[model samples]
Target: MFQGRLVQGYDFVDGDTDPSEVGAPYVNPAYGHGTHVSGIIALVAPEARIMPIRVLDENGEGDFWRIAEAIVWAANHGADVVNISFGYPQQTQLLRDLLDACSDGTTTTGKTFPEIGINRLFFSIAAGNSGDSTFIYPAADADDSNGSLAIGASTRFDRLAQFSTFHNRVKLVAPGENIVSAIPGDRYAFWSGTSMAAPIVSAVAALVKARYPNLNPVEIAERVEQTSVRISYGNPQIRINRVDALCAVTLIPPATCNP
Candidate 1:
C-alpha cells in the first residue's frame, strides 16, 4: 500500500488533514473529483506516493492565488509530479508568473523553495473541455521544452474527444472518454473530460520517474512524447499523439514504434 498524506488547502471548502478522510462525505463533496484523479495516479504507479492538494472546492473552482500557493507548497514539500485537472478560460498574469517561476524551480515570487533546485518540479495539466482551440491557464503554460505537459482528451478509438480543447500548447492526448475510476464513498464511476485525461498522463509520468529517477521533468516529458503513438484527426488533418505506457517505461527512443 502507498503511504502518503492528502494536503488540504481550500479555505472555502471544508476538508480534513487525515488521509483517511479523503473522499469522505464533507471532505470531497464535489463528487470526488480530486479522489478520482488520485485514484488514477495510484493505479498507474502503485509504488509512488500521492500528494493531493485541495486547491479547488467541491464545485471544481478555486481562487487562482490559492491555486498558486498550492503549487508552491507542492514544490516545497517534495513533489516530483503535480497533476492539475482544472483550468481557466483566460490566462492571468499572476497565474502565469507563478507557473513560470515554478517551472524555473522557484516560488511564485522568485524565491527558491528549500531543497528543490531550479526546474525540478513537473506539472501535468488539462487542456479544458471547450471543444475549441481556446487556451487554458496552467495547461497553456505547459512548455514541453520544460517539464510541463498539457494534455487533451482522446477516445478509445484513438480519436480526439468532441469536448476537448486543443491548441499548440497541448503536447499529447490520452484516453479520457468513459474512464472508470474511483469516486467518493468507495465507489467507482465512468467520467470524461480533459480533466480525466490529465491524470492518465500524470500516472505515466510517475512510472517514468520511478524508472528513471535521474531524469529531469523535461527529459521525462520527452520520454513520454517520444514514445507516443502518432494520430491524426479533424478536417485539416491536425496531428497529435497518444501515450503508450510500454514505450515510455521501456525507455525506447522516439520513432522506434510503428506510426
Candidate 2:
C-alpha cells in the first residue's frame, strides 16, 4: 500500500537489468517483509543509506542469477554493505562465482564503468531460516573463504534460534526473533528466523564502514569477529555482539595512535 510514499522496494529481475516491468505478489498478504528487514538495518545505522534489492518474488522464490546481479549492481552503485535476508534450498556454482568475482575488485559485467573506488563490497546473507542443522544455499555457498559474510540467528536470551541453520560457515550471530522494524505503508512489524538476524549484521557492517572508511570489507569482518563477545551453544560456540559496530566507526584513531 505504501510503496513509494513511506517506503521503497526493488524489482528482482529474472533475466538482465531493465528499467521497467516489476510485479510479484507476496506469499503473505503483508508485503512488508523486505521492508521490515531493510528498516532494521537502517535503524542500527541511522546515518547509513539503505539500498532495497528485491531478489525474492512475492511468492518468496529468487533465482541465483537475480541475486548475483543484485550484488554486482550494489557494488557498482556504491553500496558499502549488501544485506541478503533470504536463502534458497538449492546450490548454484554460478552464484558462488559471481560473489567471488565481485569481491575480487573487478566489474563482472565486463563493460567498463567509471571507478567507484569503494574499498570493498561485503555480502551479508542470512544463514538460513530452516531449523535443521544442515547448511543452506548461498550461505552454504561460501564453499571457499570468499569475502562474503554468512550470519546466524540468536534470540534476545542470547541463544541460537532452533530454526536457524548453523555451521562454521556462519561468521556471527545476532538478534532475530520478534525483531521490530519498518515495513510497507510505513508500518512496523516483528519478524522471526535467520532472515531477521542477517540485517542486524548488515547494519553493524554499515556502522563499521561509516566509522573506519579505510577498512575494506574483509578488514571490517575481521575487526567484527576479533572484537566480538563470545558465547556458548552446547557443542558449537556463537558470537553475540555484532562487534560494537558503532564503536568501530567512533573509535579508530586511538587504536591507530597506540599501534
Candidate 3:
C-alpha cells in the first residue's frame, strides 16, 4: 500500500491507502492498481503533481455517485488533468453528465465543475481490454465530441493489441501491451491493458497543457489528438490516433507523423 502520500478514499476503502490491503482474511487482488496508474503518469510527467483519489475497491466495483464526487473534488482542487484507467461496460447518465462538466465548464443543467486556475479538466479514460468492439462507459463518451480521450492498448509494433477494444469510441491508442510501471511493495510489474494506455495520454495532455498554457481543456486534448500518429491499421473512416508526447508538445502536424 502507498502510505505517506496524499490519498483520499470512499468509505469502502477504510483508512488504508490500498483498499486491497485493508481486509484481514482477504486482500484485494489489484493491490497496486492505483499506484501503477499513478506511476505511469509520473513517468511521463515528472513535474506534474498528482492527487490519488480512490473511488473503487480492489474488486474494480465502484459507485457512480462517489466517482462523480471525486471528479468534482479534483476539478476544484487545482487538478486540470485527470486519468481514469478504469471503466465498466454499463452506460449511466450520471457519469455522462459529469464528464461533460469537465470540458464544458458546466453541466447540461448549468452546474459548474468549478476549476481552480485553468480551463476545465481533461479526462483520459480506458477503452476496456475486452478485445472486441464493445462499449465502455465514460470512455464511451469519446464519441460525444468532448475533452475526454478514450485510449486503447497498442503493441510495441504500433499495431492494435489483441486485447484492445477498437471501435469508433476509441479515439487514440498507446503502448499498453507489456507495460512496465511501479507496483505495490516498492516494486514494479509488467501489465497490459487499455487501462495502462489511458494514463499515458493523460501525461501527454499535461505536457501539451504545459507547453501551451493558454489552450482550453478541450483545446489541449484536441492538440494531442490532432498531432497523434495515425496507425493506418484501423478503419479507414474511424481514426485511431496513437498518442505521441513529443509530437504533441512540439505541435507537429498529424500529416507529418509518418514513421
Q: Which of candidates 1 and 2 reaches a greater lDDT?
A: 1
After superposition, the stretches of candidate 3 with alpha carbons farther than 4 Å from their true spots are 1-12, 15-27, 108-119, 232-238
lDDT order of candidates, top first: 3, 1, 2
- Tens digits of per-residue lDDT, candidate 1, 211-236, equal 88898887888888889988768665
lDDT of 1 at 194: 89
- Give the alpha-carbon lDDT of every model: 0.77, 0.66, 0.77
- Model 2 steric clash pairs: 25-58, 131-163, 211-249
Error at 86, model 3, angstroms: 0.9
Best by TM-score: 3
Give the clashing pairs for model 1. 105-119
Q: Global CA lDDT of candidate 2, please? A: 0.66
**Model 2 root-mean-square deviation:** 5.3
After the best TM-score superposition of candidate 2, give how far the Cα of residue 167 lies from its true spot, in angstroms.
1.1
For model 1, give the 10-residue run with minimal summed lDDT: 5-14
lDDT of 1 at 189: 83
Which regions of candidate 1 deviate over 4 angstroms? 1-29, 106-119
lDDT of 1: 0.77
Question: How does candidate 3 score on lDDT?
Answer: 0.77
